[model samples]
Target: MYGHRKNISDVRTPDRFSYPPSPSPSSYSTSSGKSTSGRSRVRGAARSVAGVFVACFTPPEEDTHHHSSSVYGGVSDTFSSTSDFSGASDSTDGRKRGTARGIYGTRNDSTHMKEPGSVKFTIAEIHYATKNFALALKVGQGGFGTVYKGQLQDGTLVAVKRAKKIMYDNSIGGEFQSEIQALSKVEHLNLVKCYGYLQHGEERIIVVEYVPNGTLREHLDCIKGDVLSFASRLDIAIDVAHAITYLHTYTDHPIIHRDIKSSNILLTEKLRAKVADFGFARLAADVESGQTHVSTQVKGTAGYLDPEYLRTYQLTEKSDVYSFGILLVELVTGRRPIEAKRELKERVTARWAMKKFTDGFAISVLDPKLEKSEANGLAIEKILELALQCVHSHRRNRPIMRRCAEVLWNIRKDYKELLD
Candidate 1:
């Protein structure tokens, strides 16, 4: 039932004003609201710099009884006088209303206003939610810091990411504020929701939605649950595409997700994906100002970083497109971007997989954990073809995130039709 045409331009892009439709059984939904007329002004600007994807957190146990030694007293007197988390109301209505200033800003600074839905959490409330950062409640840990499963007095569950002391003292601390600004501006179904943050003395913590299931990396490795079916993987790829699309097209400013690896992709109990971790995220250079790409020190994981960015230090949304290409290869091959155990030629999975794909052996690179079906075989070929374009050395050769999502939508539609 599907056409053999694999040309990127052959598949029509979804309306610029709207998002791609949600796939069947996926909780992620697209908003039908049309974007304003100016949306397409920078449509071609998508060729700009790359960014990393969000970070992932582990799931915690249900029990909340454990309580570690209180770290409250040391910084209590300092921030308590500034933050309003000690308020009596547990509901949003009772939360204090004040300007959302930077961690170092003064209390009465009217220069910075809080974004809607943004909250300023107290150290006491943070300590209570995380049970004093108890080891038993720890969910995930990464370069950013340790994540804990926490419950508020109102019984709302959240993932509390506490920056390590060293990270707080390093460049990552700046990323902390950068992430807060980035997270505050965007909201989408496939993106993880940010609840609030805590900045007490040496403690720098971010509280976000608690996604119970582990990360996409955990699932791909089969660490958290069963092997992901081809359909599930396809769905996740689309979900992430939607998230990136939102960041690039829908936000007031185009945001580049510099990191787009599997570990940065979090999964839910239903296997729907949410793009997390904004430490490496950045706003695209203002297209309105006629600037095309932002020039900055290169940052990102080794295997997933865009080559052009590394060589030239210029970044564009297409940089993320390159990383997404690497992620697609990882999903299909079930191998890390770099596999030291493999032969020299095969050491870089993306290169090896692309070689196989171009040599007319695309199906040969399919993840061994997946069973090969007629539909599955065809899907692999189409996906790799897309990945090929995405990973092209030249940024202009890559498809925009919007185009990527559209291609994936067609792939899923065709695959499901073939299965039926």
Candidate 2:
């Protein structure tokens, strides 16, 4: 039982959630170097960051400050490149699909207004649900703010996210708007659902579905729950693939999940994976706009960021593909992208594993905790092969999310057959 606020240390990784701050005030000013008013500057910055971020619960740190942004330029819709994803698509049994807001002196007017259909929770109701933000109700914390577990009058369990006040002065306000915009537009079995939101004077709170199980990062760290078997890991991978696929292709305008790491992946009691946090999410370029990628500021975690995105500041769906590739390596090797404690050659887990894979020792990269078998070894090779394609240096070479999902389906089918 999580009786105390800090008791859920096992549920999240504190050191993994350090998001880099958004661009400085200079980035928000006009080309002439004229200083913009506070209102204009905030609005300009918010438009720049059309994404969301929901870091896992870490106890609030007084000295810690963080910012979120969609610093890149124009949005484009270019999900065109698709490599043949021919793989074993054997039919499998169907699985069940499962499915925020701020406070204020009540400033209901934001350039990024919440779309209709998203319930608006009054500040008073939020206070009652959260027991006035009592320490006991706290579930998670991060650079954005603190999260508390609450139950609504209708008996719906929700996770209420409260942004740090200082964050309002920076990009948190934009992050909040971007998250609402992204979450409000999409619904998928593998994505987290938004319940409502409350925005009081200085307080910004987003209410979301409560995921009982801890994050995938916690599970990989062996700090929470049961060992994740190869089969379970595969299922979770497919679930995530589905979520990303929905975001990239099914949405009215393609959405790019700027950040995709283990810490942002929350699991349900049934061990189903739900892609959480859209603070770093933004709309992709419009296909009809004759654009290719969203030229946004460099945003995303360190190891998982695409090399091309960093170099050119051009973002595409393949950016997510690159991160997913890293995620695949993480799942297979059960190692962080960067293991600071590792030796010189082994420090970067992805590169180290890729070397082992290319040298005809792919199985060597397998997590020692996993059982070694012909099926498992073969699955690892197949997965890393797909991962290799994902982490390709060029975005064009990386497979689309839909293609990745297809390949994973085949891999899962083959893995199941090998076991039989």
Candidate 3:
């Protein structure tokens, strides 16, 4: 539990959190000496939530008396002395020696001190925010854990995911650490932002920027018995593709989002897609020499699993591509990846769609809810072609994330021009 208290300002009501006013654009400058005038214009236009602040820090150099308060609101909490603090480099350790605070307020060797920019959340604070994991706050449940909606004392909303018993007890903390490390390294508009993480007793919690719109699966199926518009579907596809492209090609280590399904894709209030759920994701160990395969247990939703990769247990970025293809099929056809309505042999929608496409009966497989407009027909065909290319049985035959992103972007661009 956290042990700390400070005077609270009485400027706002309990429902309205208050954040410190941000610096003006004229007051900011980039490391490149560029003024942040244009950047500020965009940022200033965003809806400001009370009590949320994004603070950047710089660790002191060696032998510098770096006096700092506890990172999480000066809270004093106990952590296991055996916890690994290997994330810091030798130089950072030398500088932070005797001045760093571990999770809660447990003092540790400077070696356990993390570099600046790594997020740290207090376990007691999160428990208070989520009302001790109240059932009403539960948003979604997955293989790894249940996600709950929370609000900080400042009233900033967040989504906190508590790892399941199996993942927490069996993984030796690797799963949570891996997710924090991977998410911290990447930043994209279409990817969910991880605010911080905490480890308390047997509980592991990840704090992320909350998306209010809900999951793609829920919007597609729960809201109405109708398929999404071609343009909206294409936009979601493009956003997700861009996010994946950022992970695979732009990062220091290529990341494979092992699970790529509607349920894992979240929508924002603006309907923009944000890819979530990194429990099954993995970062390619070597960036220069791409991995051909990775050995792991067969993991993934039934219909979305890549047949070749599942059989071989050899994973690569292509595995993600294949899963995305199944998702695309679901978007276009309005059918579950594995529809039990079909004959026993043709139950899998991907296999059935492929067969239908080959027989020149693709239109018959299109979601009936989608109107037979010219634009809709063209969009379906274009997306179907891309999906087919992605789900090609041969892993090498699948396009990389960059290509997939480009294709989707171009489709969106063309559709926009048509509308204009």
Local distance difference test, per candidate? 0.64, 0.65, 0.57
| Counted clashes in each candidate structure | 19, 39, 4
lDDT ranking, best first:
2, 1, 3
Residue 411's lDDT in candidate 2? 76
Model 3 lDDT, residue 359, Cα? 40
Residue 231 displacement in candidate 3 (angstroms): 0.8
Flag regions of model 3 displaced more than 4 Å.
1-117, 165-167, 171-173, 224-227, 285-291, 344-346, 417-420
Candidate 2 lDDT tens digits, 1-420: 100011111222122232123233222221212233522332222221111111111212232233332111111111111111112212221111212111101122222225422888899889888999898988877766888888887777778888878768546676778788888877677777777677779988888777888788889988889889999899999989988987887666778887888888889899999888887788886555356676666566756777666655677788898889889999989998778798966867776766565444778888888987777877776676677667665565566777778778877887888788
Q: Assess candidate 3 and give its TM-score to the true structure.
A: 0.68
Candidate 1 structure quality by residue, lDDT tens digits, 120-174: 8999998899889898998766656778899887777888888878655446566
Question: Tens-digit lDDT track for model 3 on 151-255?
Answer: 877776778878766655444365567677777766677777677788777878888767787777766775723346767778898888878777766665567
Off by over 4 Å in 2: 1-117
- Determine the backbone clash count of candidate 1: 19
Cα error, residue 48 of model 1, in Å, equals 23
Task: By TM-score, rank the candidates, best first.
Answer: 2, 1, 3
Better of 1 and 3 by lDDT: 1
